[model samples]
Target: MSSSTQPSDIIIGRTFGALFIGVTIAAVLFGLSCVQSFVYFQTHRDPGTTFYKLVVICLWILDALHLAFIVHCVYYYLVSNYANITAPMDVVWSFKLQILFEVLIIQGVHSLYLYRIWIVSQGRSRILPIIVGIVIMSNSGVAIALIWALYQCSMFSELNKIEWATFLTLGTITFADVVIASSLCYLLATSRTEFSSTNSLITRLMVYIINTGCLTSMCSMAAIITCAVMPTNFIFVAIEFLLAKLYVNSYLALLNARYYTEVNTDTNNSDTFHNRHGVYRPELHVRALDDDELQVSRKDLFKHLDDTVHPSRSVKEPALAVTTEMNSFSSV
Candidate 1:
């Protein structure tokens, strides 16, 4: 029935064609999300927002994914780098598979922040500082490894080599991310601390970050599996971009540290004001006490184990709110 390809027949055939439309669309969206998040974080900063710094930390991860996918997209789709895109099906899938884990790492970051916010908001003091170290080590290591793999792949000319190299590396990154991210989630879900609304403002952002990170990980996993098995897909490129965008936009949301908690220490009892993204406001807490109050500033509180006299690791509950000896703010 080769009648110069009838209009109806051509349309039907094209519709059923094996074109990688799904992957292509996803890549574009991921890239845009990353850029959005990146800009969001930079514009948002208030010195008092202690937790927002973590959000800034989140920016680096999203940026990495964005850049990785950018490289992947250029190499696969762009004119000059087109020579690098050749591969059979499953082998080419490694690039997209790798990107999926990268996105998951970003997601894990958001989850960790969310848990912290939840802990602070609830005033649950059970959170130890060491957890931060575990997260930093685990996530950063995988990201570095993945980026290294990408560089290695970039330098190669053959498909088999890229597959052999990236496949194992990506699998390791994914496995590690799942373990640590799950631990963070478990910590948050079981947190018992309950801070007043005074801690609500900034705390809200942290919790929100966690939720966003969770959603991202859940959805990205499915996409990665499909790409890994299918390969030679334009869809992979689009998904990569979209994932990048998600990472970046999430970081941008995190830049709103000022919108959360603001600490004001007076001569007597320290006052805590809990803000919820500049919406619900509350009166400042005023109390009478000695010039010496047990109020810990973010500066005094190291990310984790810096206190030598009473090493926190030894103690189950390390005092983040270290009773300061210095007096900066006077009484009213």
Candidate 2:
């Protein structure tokens, strides 16, 4: 092979190799998210709202489809079309399907966060939701247009031909993520109760909001920058492949946190129940409540507490259990 052929080979290898690696990593994450979803549904069967459960299921399906589509793209590029007397490959229909699935995954996750914002704000502000909603919808629209334009382009090398649309779509996604993180952190901070346990839960939630939201936005920014700098290269495509997985994994992480917290809380409650009945652990300060308080659902128990109740006694009563339950509930 000539020297010219070597460079061509390297470029082809790099492009398809990066995609293969990205798809593999994304598939692993998707599989993990599926396991997490299963455990999540089993542990927290009642996600309070049917909508929340539906979101989880939808996200899972979208992520799976995204992974499958990418795998097919890889196979077609590397095997089926391998022998074509090719220059750089053109964006095929499989690639378009991948982009569409990505858009769906992103939009679904964004909607989930928007719902969180509404709940965290106690439905008080219509303004934030409307603003964020517009941004999300606009981003999705631009993304679709970009994909359409991508198909119209004669070659993948001409990605820069639709540069404006590309940047707008990515920039909008990053902006939406920033707005979501800031809104969630601010609202959650303001809603904090003076109770120690509640504060602990809120702190964890805030950390989750920041980590997930920031990481996704940063990935988006990276993709946008890469595309701007090297539109003809597959570098941006490699990064873009990771975005959907990151979003899904982040959302799944938030859900899994609830499950672990519930398990811990249940252990504490069982220990308390056992102690109160037979062997009392004085260090825990667990009090023996009447059957009524015990029978009262965790949701109702919180409503039963008055503002003036002592913190120590409240911890020993149903209050602590309710706190754990509510933390899991509200954080979702």
Candidate 3:
């Protein structure tokens, strides 16, 4: 090949190669998410979890559609236009429509995280949720603007015209992830109980929250950096293809974690405790509670702690205190 055509060949390789790698990773994540959803529905048959099951179903459908769009875009560029040297520069309809699915998936996952923060803080921390909500909404707007810009342009190189939108969208997403993770960590740390087991569980939850947030944030940062450094390549587009799958998989992981926590809690503690009469008494056997009930249980935990510290001054029987054993992310 002549020297003049070498750069074109390299660009083609990078453009299609990135798309292939991204779609491959996304397919793997999607498969894992499907397994998680199946396990969740098979195990959690309670009426309280119906809403969560529906959310999972919706996300799975969106993810499947998103993957289809990516596949079509790649096939259109690489297979259908195999002999066309200028094919990589042309834009496809699937490329623009995928932005809509991406924005919707992100909105759903971020909303769930916000709800968890609300429950963990017992509705006391309003400022953080409001700020995160605003950022998320702004990001959605930027995504729409980006789609519009893509629609207006016939060539991939034209994306530079609305580069600001791309930067804003990724920046807002990273900001929201960081804020949500930090808020959850702070709230969980402050909710530590006197019992070591309870505190340990809270610490585990904090670590999980941080890891989930960091994964998504790192992906967004990678996309942003690639877009800025190589505006003419499709590496950023490839990263975008994986973003929805990451969000869906993370949400499913959060939900499925409850089963492991419940098993661990039950196995570590005895079902019955000896009372003051030296007789074995059955522990309070309430079903797993949702977020609202979890909040009530937390209050009972604090009240029980107070009574234990000052038994002589207490008048009423102690409230049932098993909040520590319950999974913090049980509902949201």
Candidate 4:
């Protein structure tokens, strides 16, 4: 059979093919996140309150649904009865479910960061929280625009409208991520205590805030650039597909770090600063409060530490440590 396909059509198909690969990788990361989450539940006998458990459960459900929808989109393109029609790419309905799921996942991850900032600030900062809330709402609005674009846009010529949505959504997310990372770093810096151990712990947390926030922010920026440069191409789609995986993985890494930190803290070892890999582990020390004076809840401990102290690592191995340490000061 001989056929002449438009260059644009070929580009679209190739983009979808690349998207399939990206989605597959995302699915694998999702599985890894689930495994980490399960280990977290098993290891931390007293992880947190029921609300935290509920959030984890909801994230699991969202992850499962996200994967399912992506798989369906792939199947539709690769094996469905309408596969020969090239309808999947031309129709908005084909991708709305996946896009919706992506938005929900992003929102959940963003909310977690907001919670971190709120706790770290001890609810004192009025402006930063409001900015984050506004950014989140803006991102949500972009998601709605995306859905509307998908619904109203039925062909390649109409992709211009969706491009605007893509730009706004990704730009807002990147802005929000930068805000989170910078805010955490500032708060942690100001919260440093005179005690070496507590300062070490805060330093560790600052590392994580940088890695996690920078990672997501960078991903979102890359997506925004691609979307802007090649609004009609699928390259942006491929890049954006990984956003959810990054979000889920970053959060899971934090949870796993909490487990390792608890084990180290309870061992009562002097060189708790370094782990088996010789990486500086974040260790916390309670100085002012005598053992009998007050029993500190993890949340209270972080709050009390933040109230009392003020201020203040490397890359390579240290970067690995920061990425590995997921337990924020609140969890400690």
Candidate 5:
């Protein structure tokens, strides 16, 4: 609790300030992209009113909100760290709200992707494939609390003592997210035809998810070891901000790359697919992953995963449906 043990707080005013500014811009760009995408989808609906379509729409909205939240955090991180170092307990409690929202952000990612993989894999896989998302969300909740402690508890020097249990709990949860995500990738990879029906969109997505998870895991490890490593200095906290910026920005890049355009070739079908109202537009199909080599590639990726899935599991008309949809929309 002594001043000597306090972290060597850096002059984060400018650094965090710049980050806040940049992320706020990114948030705006993200919002713009979301609007653009919504307009496009609203112009092209084929399957009519379906629950799955609604789910995808919800994911996009949540993602946009998540970006906005990141912008908010960027501001708070700077403001809280220096401008107002000593917040009243009630204010600190309010700050915890932002930290808790971080969990919701991550949970949004899981909910959006987990079900897709399950459906693509035909709902016939290990139970971990299904419930692992819940575990991920649960642990994220714990991480949020611990994350709050890292800041808010530090507000009260006497209560700054961190719990190892909390560390392990959150760490384990991160590991679980990684493991399940990897499994999802493998399941898709080995599915009878590489992801041919889905094009590289799904594969790109899976790779991006893997990369994000790995980086997040690395950040968590660095954080957990900070106690034994530097033990002092705002260095760890600064690193944390940097990692967070990377996580959010990288995700935005993925959104832009994955959703900003009709990357794949698949948009032929139109079932009132979000086209504002009842409208007719084409769908997009990524590319063909229907060859044996692609299948082999899939097999290789999932070599370590234990799912019994195979390339033959791929649906026969996934590409056709996508291609027809894309062509149909383009013609519109």
Candidate 6:
């Protein structure tokens, strides 16, 4: 081999090696996501959870497709075109199609977060969620444009021509993530009450939101920086491969968190009062809270404590008043 050809060979190896590592990590995360989805379905059987179940199903399907495309792209370059020096420079169809799946998965997760923000604020803070929604939609638009541009490119070098689209797509996503995390943290912080248990739960939620948001944002930022610094390298493409899986797993993680919250609350309130009158009294109230509709108001908390402390008061007739309040956050 000529001396000059060694540099190109090293680059090809690095590119495919990065692709392999990214896809491997993505597959691991996808497996975790599948487990989370199964747990969600098994634990939450109420009819109200149909929407969330559907969301999980849809995202999982999209993630499967995305992974398949990535595998095909890697196979095309590394296996199908083995020993061909020029193969790395050519673009494959799967490489272009995966962007669409990524955009859809990301949008789905973002929309769910936006819904949570709206619910946490009890529809009072409408402007922030709306603005975030607009930004998310704009990001999706740029991602579509980026996919179209990728489709137009026949060579790896051609990606440089559409750097703007790449930057905008990643930039908007990171921005939205930051905004969502900050908003959730700020809102939850403000909703904190004097109760130690409630405050503790709120703190846990804030920490979780911060961690997940930072994770996805950091991945996006890394992709943007790598793409800008080394447009010819496959490092950015590898990062892109991981982005969708991260979002999907994040969504599933959030959903599955309800189980932990429930267990903790139950352990803490093990001696909770149950009506002993057995006259169909409206004293004991136990309700299952949905993940999306997890709201705990101060009034409800005070009422629950009051009922628990003073269970002597009973209903005049055979009446039942059941109120479902999530143990986690009163306003999360």
The top-ranked prediction according to lDDT is 6
* Per-residue alpha-carbon lDDT of candidate 3 for residues 1-332, written as tens digits (9 for 90 to 100): 11233336556667788899998998898898889889888866766645577788999999999999998988898899886877766678888888888988998898877766655455365787677678767767777877677688876666777788888888888898898789767866777755555466667667777898899999999999998987767799899898899999888877765455556755433332222235432333342323234434433432321122211121122323444433222222
lDDT of 5 at 20: 60
Candidate 2: stretches off by over 4 Å: 1-10, 46-49, 265-332
Q: What is the C-alpha RMSD of each candidate to the true structure, in Å?
A: 11.4, 7.5, 8.2, 9.4, 10.5, 8.7
TM-score of 4: 0.75
Taking all chains together, each candidate's TM-score versus the true structure is 0.42, 0.78, 0.78, 0.75, 0.53, 0.77
Question: Would you give me the overall lDDT of model 4?
Answer: 0.64
Off by over 4 Å in 1: 1-157, 164-207, 255-332
lDDT of each: 0.41, 0.69, 0.71, 0.64, 0.49, 0.71
* 1-332 per-residue lDDT for model 1 (tens digits): 12133233223112112223534544565555555555545544435554544655555555555455545544453344333323221123345455656546455654554444343333334454345445445555655665555554432222334443334443443453445445444543443233222233324534654665654554456446645764333333344345545555544544433322322323124322122123332222221122122233232221121121210112112222222211122221
Question: Model 4 misses residue 291 by how many Å?
Answer: 8.6
| Model 6 alpha-carbon miss at residue 247, Å | 0.5
Off by over 4 Å in 3: 1-10, 47-49, 123-125, 271-332
lDDT of 5: 0.49
* Candidate 1 accuracy as lDDT: 0.41
Error of 1 at 8 (Å): 26
**lDDT by residue (tens digit), candidate 6, 1-332:** 11233335547645888898888888898898889889888877866645677888898999999999999988897899887877777778888888888888898889888876666565355787788778778877887888788788887667677888889989999999999888877876776654555566667767777888999999999999998786656788899999999999877877665565656765433133222233332322323222212233322322211122211122212111112233322223
Q: Model 5 off-target regions past 4 Å?
A: 1-94, 130-134, 137-141, 144-159, 163-166, 194-206, 218-332
